[model samples]
Target: MTTFYTVIDWLMVFGYWLLIAGVTLRILMKRRAVPSSMAWLLVIYILPLVGIVAYLSFGELHLGRRRAERAKAMWPSTASRLNKLKESRRIFATEYSPVARPLFQLCDRRQGIDGVKGNQLQLFTTTDETLKALIRDIGLARHNIDMVFYIWQPGGLIDQVAESLMAAARRGVHCRLMLDSAGSLQFFRSSYPSMMRRAGIKVVEALKVNLLRVFLRRMDLRQHRKVVLVDNYIAYTGSMNMVDPRYFKQDAGVGQWIDLMARMEGPVATTIGIVYACDWEIETGKRIFPPPPDVNIMPCEQESGHTIQVIASGPGFPEELIHQALLTAVYSAREQLIMSTPYFVPSDDLLHAICTAALRGVKVSIIVPRGNDSTMVRWASRAFFSELLEAGVNIYQFTGGLLHTKSVLVDGQLSLIGTVNLDMRSLWLNFEITLVIDDDGFGSDLACVQEDYIARSTLLNAKEWQKRPFWHRLLERLFYFFSPFL
Candidate 1:
């Protein structure tokens, strides 16, 4: 009996190795980032069964058959809109700088959105300021209002926006509200959706969390976009959710979170409407009836603003458009670069580009929070600081509050703001939106906001870093191993 049991155990071990080899083969066929692929292989090799379970939960981006069909059905309408815009656009090649033109052109090809004229950009730095702006504009909403957000916790700023939305719905505004089930759990479980429904506001929860919804897609995929469109003429997009930043965490040394938003009044508002409509359609599996007031409903504002393109990205795309755009923009940068993001786990290509740029005489500075809520993220980010410091890249830790803004400004001639974070999940999993603007005036305004953030930041020098406890630094390096997926 012992001999028979030994033989059986050996057979099981052989089968497990065989299964791992098969999984590794499958991962290689997808051609993911080298580090990511290697990380999976390492995990699988260490504990085959447990690793397989982990991979099943996190590795796949498959959205299943029904969702795949729904997403496919969305494209024809999207293509139709793109074609219509192409035929009707007023071309002004000279409006964009030569350096910025190719990047925009690349995004135009990959993203459904295109450059639209007559759009003015307003940069808001403070949480109160943005919430006030949303309330003011929402109050002015006449024909309709549409808002899609990831997190909508019920509290100070969040409740105020909800009240405004409900008021608009009561006033007969065609108000539509969409929230992500995973991110907005607090509000989703609250009576807000019911209250809005009572007030005649349409509500849809994207990626509903349930066993049935799990079968809809790899459960990790989320809708992380924040967009607000009022009457098809004005829009707001950025990192701020309809929640109080202070509630992001409790007992963290950081008192409150700081974020940024962009207010746009232009044809780009129509573009934002299109993006929201797509999300709404996918979640409900129904067309946006009445077809969303035509893009030309308002008189063409020949001079209301400049040209800007709204870029949307997600797992559905053939490639990572946001990541590509950022990489391309960073490569094209010549003089100085400034960035701010809460998360710091960047892809290998992006991190190298940043370090290289600093080496090549470009001033590269990035501001992140001194103490993030996630201990793993904080440690991993600090692990990266040594390399950044060695390359002469100035690293600033925001001391005032949690720096939740995600932005990239190249040479102070371009500005990008939206829901994207400098992390793998934002690059690969979430549905995100960002506006790429090349207007110098708007870029200058964005730079000023960044300047205020820099003022409240503490620069970490190499000497100070080297004096940290050895165990802390070791843990930082160890935590960095998970950065490929973090």
Candidate 2:
């Protein structure tokens, strides 16, 4: 019996390898990047069972061929809008803000966000303020309200927003909501979607999860966009999720849920609305393409001297706009670079950029949460910090609360505020959006925010970090070893 059991186990191992080899051969034949394919191959070859699990989790691209075809078909329309925005900016060159020029060009060349004039942008600093503004915008919508969020839960502030959305739906306002199936599973499984649907709101789940679907598609790539576009004129995008307590916390009221949200009106809003429409069409198979030509393009009351461009990223898009945009902005920084993110995992390229910048005399500072929610990620992040500190990059850990803001202030001239975090998943895996603003005033405001965080946070000096216990360092090393998956 023992001999028979051993033979069966060996046969199972052989079957697994055979499966992995077949998939790898197919992927290679499809001409996927050699490095990526090789990496996957290595995982499967070395740790057969675990590699199969990891590959199933994060290997195959999630979007099916049909969805890819749809995105390709829609590319022309997106490109046309981008070209129009580019031409409009050129025609109004003198009217365009100088601070916004680099960002506009960066967006056009990188992320495809057109710089539209006469748009107002308001920055909200807290979740309460963000929710209040979001609810107000939803309530005031005249034509349509489109929202796409990673997490949309019921009860508390989110429930209030849901009620308002339902109310708007009943009033004949076209209300459509899209939530990531994976991120909002708990909410959807609860009474949220049914409750909203009964109130006349249309809700679609992006990427439903099933065992077979899990085998065929990657579950790690998520639609992590938090956007609310109303009436094709006003839009909201940022790090804030539509949930009570902002995010899941055990204490429920342990810390202030800090976030940064931006309200925009102009061509940018239309751009945001288009993003929502594209996602909606993809998920619901209902086309709401070609927004109305008469959508308002009014100039906003200016509060900052910076020019702003909105950059959107997703699996449907080939270019990694947010990541490239950050690299470009950081490389362009002359004096100082300050960034704050809830998650601080960095890609090798980003890590190089920061280290190189700091070494070159650019004062680079990064503020991250002291106690991150993920144990592995926190340990992995710490593993990278020592090198950065050694390279002269200043590190601060926010102590007051969960620092859930993705913001960067560069040289007091360029400011980037949005939903993308400084991590591998955000940069390469998940869909994200960010606003790159070219304004002295916006930079100044961001600088003030950074300074305030620094004042409250504890700086991680190199010596202090080096003095941590051996067990902690070993844990960090263990976490770092598996960071490629993390």
Best by lDDT: 1
In the order shown, the candidates' Cα RMSDs to the true structure are 2.5, 3.6
lDDT of 2 at 375: 80
lDDT of 2 by residue, 1-486 (tens): 999999999999899778978866765775544545666777788887788777766776667656667777776777776566555442122333443455567666665544544556788887778888888988898888888889876667877788889989989998888889888888889987887898778888887776676666677778899998888878888888887663467463437656778887656676676677677666666677646434234433432223456677776775667777788877877789999998887877788999999999999999998877678888989889989998999999998887888999888877888889887778877778887776676677778878888898999988878889999999998777666556
* Per-prediction TM-score to the true structure, in the order listed: 0.93, 0.89
Which residue ranges in model 1 land beyond 4 Å of their true spot?
A: 1-15, 91-94, 211-216, 246-248, 289-304
Candidate 1 displacement at residue 227 in angstroms: 0.4
Task: Write candidate 1's Cα lDDT for 222-259 as tens digits.
Answer: 88999998888888999998888766655887678788
So what's the TM-score on candidate 2?
A: 0.89
lDDT of each: 0.82, 0.76
lDDT of 2: 0.76
